[model samples]
Target: MKKLFTTDFKQRCINLMLHEQHTVAETSKIMNVSISALQRWKVQYIKEKQGITPVKPAITAEQREIQRLRTEVEQLRSDNALLKKVSAFFLDKH
Candidate 1:
């Protein structure tokens, strides 16, 4: 039968490997889990603590939109400035 660990238990396992300085192998053995599972949990915990969650996918979409808007705005500004310059040059000539 497979064992299902709770959130608290999963955090505890990660803490043992991190704060307690236990190796992944040791934590897996002590927690009765696979080493791969412990390693995966540790990676997720570290990423979460570093503010790099899977939620970044949403931020990525926002960032892409912001970049696109910025590019469009810059192009518009450049076109407007060029038109103004042309208008001023024609006014001076006339």
Candidate 2:
């Protein structure tokens, strides 16, 4: 059976993947959708914005490595922020 979704809902999903930096697979899983469905939605969303449909690009190993590094950097930044907050709290106590 084919399910009908609103344009607003599709835009929100695309926003999650684009603006929020969520991976397509992550957004798909979170939204209870298939990755391919999300990909198609993304393409439609782009076309709506730019008036042109972009070709799907293949994922390369270097792209994967860059994504992995970006994730790691975000994690490290979060850990550093937590450590700073803890340090400030202890220093205030002393």
RMSD of each: 11.2, 13.5
The alpha-carbon lDDT assigned to residue 5 of candidate 2 equals: 70
In candidate 1, how many Å is residue 51 off? Answer: 0.7
Per-model CA lDDT versus the true structure: 0.73, 0.73
Task: Residues 9-81, candidate 1: write the lDDT tens digits.
Answer: 8878988988899999999889899998788777766766555544322123344455566679999999999
Q: Candidate 2 versus the native: TM-score? A: 0.52
Model 2 segments beyond 4 Å from truth?
A: 53-94
Q: Pick the candidate with the highest lDDT.
A: 1
TM-score of each: 0.53, 0.52
Q: Model 2 over residues 1-94: C-alpha lDDT tens digits?
A: 9877765677678889999999999998888888888898777556545544234321333433555666799999999999999999999999
